[model samples]
Target: MSPLKPAFFELAVRADARWDRFSRGVRRRMGLARPLRILPYRGYGTAERVLIQARVLEDRFVKPSHLRRSLVGSAIASYKRYATVEIPGARVAVHWGDKRWEGTTDDEGFLELWVAPPPGVRPGWNVVELELLEPEPQGVPIVSAQVLVAGPQAELGIISDIDDTVIVTGVTNPLKRAWALFLTEHRTRLPFEGVDAFYSALREGHGGLADNPIFYVSSSPWNLYEHLDEFLALHRIPNGPLLLRDWGLSRHGFAPGGGHGHKLEKIRGVLGTLETLPFILIGDSGQEDAEHYRTIVREYPGRVRCVYIRNVPSRAQRAVELERLAQEVREAGSQLVVVDDTVSAARHAAQAGWIRWQEVPRVQEHQQEDADARTVLDALGRKGS
Candidate 1:
């Protein structure tokens, strides 16, 4: 790691203090409050350009023992951190919650606002666009992250997939897939071996690294969320928004192209909602994730930082298509990562410096998640008994 330049670090420290003072002054004037301590990960995740998160505060909850009359409690709560930037003299309008909130940036180029979020709004991703005065301004982007109201920390966001990438099922086989889903409905789905610990490492942020927002987007239908949730829980996987394909019922049957289209639409929706914060995408080669991700890279350009693809056995024709798609993905500015298995993928991910080496703890821990998964598989053996 490179040593920080003393001069630059000093400047950063001073600037941070000034920003806080400015925020404090604005909050005082507005009759609101700012956080005294900046607690980490209870708030947001740090990506390449943006740090995004939800609102959380610390509180305590009690747990009861079934056999005993005693109750045990743990301290836990979440906070919501919402701060705004305003250009006082220079007029600016922010579009949020279907209505435009008007404000201007002050002399120090700061804005303060009190936002009451609308109902049904999930806490994962949101955008705040600045409605500028002029039509064609040179080189100034007009969007910022829509964050929480009072929290001093942030959580990192992770967007991933299922089917051959995280699990071993092929989504293309509708009947077989349905049957398999039925058999393993609430049981653990097959993890791609080391994925569980990789996920755990990301959540725990092994070293001084920050935690992130984790999402799962799949071509799977909305009907499968319960089962998918069960699978994740069984594997001890953490949670975020599970974006699913909503293939509406039709008299004849479900549309063939609906899943692909729904997946693309979900990707776009996720992008739009998370316009401020970028994310990492993980999927497999069994289907069109590469091609779809290539298109997303083209559309969003630099928003996509890294892509992890698990290479399943691809048909020759599909192999040719994936090769072409991989090239296109490279051209769009993100790298196309291909891995043989989850262990090798984690090794490559660490090698590429995407994830840290210390995250795995021990290679055997990876084997343990696999071993646990195998135990689940065996427990299912006597299902018909």
Candidate 2:
């Protein structure tokens, strides 16, 4: 990595911050600044400790439209997410049933509070209420962040990647990824079909009764957190804590293989946190997911039950490399199955007795339906053009 790259990136970030501060001041003078809202992300924890992840962003999230979106509308909504202004140094008071804790937002308007779990908290969704108490209370609204506490009966925890594995983001292909990020609406972004069924099956560990926890660990910046969350919920994917990393400021700067260490760190952190439960790691062959997951499988020994590598269509070299890593995973007393789609992974899971054998057909059926719908949509789009 060039030494100047970090310097230049810092310069750009500082410039953007200066512009935001200046523009925000102007908006305030004109009495037109966007309202301050507490944006709390979905968090997960154990019975003893819970993490609360949230941000203080200008209240500018565009409500996603249910009807088919025009390209213009999609572009506008997508751009609004990226252009959000952060409100730093805000004091937020967090409240959970009988417990209370307070924290201040950082320079990026983000807060992560690790507090003792509220007494008598169950294994399912628990609520954490956040109220912005400082900055003179512009309406001082209390917002709820649903935090999942894993139950002891969980057969195994699942850790998944979002981009390419779950959705069709051409991260390796810059132009395609840029279009998907900047213009594609959440409703329009395509998810890997049958993934919902497959994930649901895994989530239902035994006899369709287990309450397994799934955590999505992605290198995609936190700026896209809400978009990704909405996409998961829209597609009926089993929701979990999305552990996305922050943007830029990496030591490698823009160099290839810069940002992916975040995935390894997050994955490891999840495994370490829930020490008793083994994990099933799911990611795509795209970029470094395979490499990162393989590291977990080897390092954690029998802690990981299996690793599923979704084979996204791209360079042949990635496929070959992933095939090679499968042996390493198996040698570590675990399996890394490189599958072409959701159906294949579901089949493997069923055979492994991880999911009911009945779910195989449903996964296959959903995959076919999703593929057919995509074909129809493509044809319609071409004709319209």
Candidate 3:
């Protein structure tokens, strides 16, 4: 399919407005009036401009039952208990520094405003305040979301995928992945071995103070933002802005590609905005990441320093396709490495002078420990059987 155009999104916004009006009419007929709420997800941008986005929803409380230990139970609880009642055609104001931007929520009860940051705003973890101005003054019901601005001192930008690349979400397997997502809590879920060390080394760069900006682009929906954010912090992964998609139905129809278009658009926007900084593209081989990264490498030429694909067992059949993409990436003046583990990728980065070589053993040790733990678990399972 062709890339999504600005007009396409505008049309979607209009459709959402119509649906919101219809839904409100039905609510009125049913004599139901719920309080309005604004749910803003974290966003990222540069010093020049920042993107602030939020969803305006009616307040709907669903009390939780006792937390479950199984993955399926947890997943069901999260989906059923956590509330999302989008309020379409709602107006909200976004304030960052001294500047303000006003925007109305679309059919999905989502509002996104791109506003220029103040001239002297520095990089690293800046907050943008949001307020609801429509549907009878709901007060500041939402907390401010953070926007990470890449500063001039940043050596290179790192755009990484979140699923199997960082955390083991088993994206290649529907059943196992579902179990992990719903059954396990964020704090309990484990990241790939040595991912933290590898990313930390990349963030520090050659001089150990590059403060290189890292942007996490994920196919996961915005509803899971808090869960993923907690996972990142728990694993001590390098912090940055998260680019996530909106779930649920859209105006046009069912999104056939399962958000590949949305992922591509967000990645392209980030690449275009941070034109000066070359990026290290990191993702897993389980999905179309290799395809997307190859397209990015070819599209932007030397702007991409390297493409790292974490090899997964399920995608072993795609080796040929990955090889072809590697050649394409090389021809485009960038390198592509299909690594079996995070340590391999870290070693490559160390050799390239992107990180210190001394850190390689630390990453390897972490990987080995994870392998040992898994082996022990497998042995115990066999014995139990």
Candidate 4:
């Protein structure tokens, strides 16, 4: 069939009707169909023409490259989009309904597929995705969207932690940290079950970005800033501003009590910078996230919307401290919620109307599951176990 008309795949994005109009015009003019594209050439062909197959290459590793370059408007700006997901000896199949779209990746896993809606695809809430057929398991959440006929302009922000949050390397040891990152890309993260869904729900904005901001804050060193994007993308974690620690190595000199205080300072700076906007904070009980939130609540009072603390380790004294902090949070105006895992946090956020939840696979933790949740609580109380 001839190319599918742009109008056929035109779906409204929240809070961007005018921009959407312009976008649709551009898509029509440029014949941009699918926003979803892949890279890394598994099957061999000429540099330009590679076969689009449906299989995951285990030996094949996908790396980032500037292959598909295009220009926009008058500026001859180069497109520097890179593909990081490497499939060894594998290929992906982009299927819509029963129809299949054709494309393939070069050595860099770059697939030059037409960006068009599939045939027989209807309007409103359709599964637009590319499935990794070669790999094991028939169906997985590659990517999907709820296409709407009309929508509004929307923004998204992500609030998260630093150590053991997105990055597996806790602020403990350098060698262990390097091992964690090297073995598992950020995507290989073992986030609390259902976190992927929670993030997706926010990214999709079931409503609009006004309801969410794709911003994230962590107590990690600022040095890891460059790796965050790849890490988040690998794990399919949503994208957002990563609030990192500037103290300790580069610019900010290390203080007496390590960079813990430095991290809190960064969090405070983020709060002040985003003072005018309402936000949500997701963190672990590992560092001073809760304490920082307490400060934020005390300072801004009604500015913060919700606070979710991932239960970790602390003493009885710290537990008492948290209780006091919780009281402060409540008084300042936001809710202080504690959950065992990230998945639970997402649910609580949904139930509490703090955030809209999305569907994701459950993550099973064999080791942490056996550990005592209260052991950390004891540490919080200062009564060392």
The number of the candidate with the highest lDDT is 2
Stretches > 4 Å off in candidate 1: 1-156, 204-209, 250-259, 361-364, 368-385
- Per-model TM-score on C-alpha atoms: 0.56, 0.91, 0.86, 0.48
Q: What is the C-alpha lDDT of each candidate?
A: 0.54, 0.82, 0.79, 0.47
lDDT of 4 at 46: 18
lDDT of 2: 0.82
**Which lDDT tens digits does candidate 2 get at residues 85-186?**
787677899999877888987656889888888677899888889998876477858999999998887899999998898888888789988898777767
Q: 134-167, model 3: which lDDT tens digit per residue?
A: 8756454746877788887788989999989998
All models, RMSD in angstroms: 18.1, 2.8, 3.6, 18.2
Q: Model 3 has how many clashing residue pairs?
A: 3
The candidate 2 region of ten consecutive residues with least summed lDDT is: 248-257
- What's the count of clashing pairs in each model shown? 44, 0, 3, 58
Q: How well is each residue in 72-122 modelled by candidate 1, as lDDT tens digits? A: 111110001112222223345555568566554333233333344544544
Question: Residues 270-372, candidate 4, lDDT per residue (tens digit)?
Answer: 4554444456777766667788777766777667777777676555566676677788889888878877766676566566554554332222232243133
Off by over 4 Å in 2: 1-30, 61-63, 248-257
Pick the winner on lDDT between candidates 1 and 3: 3
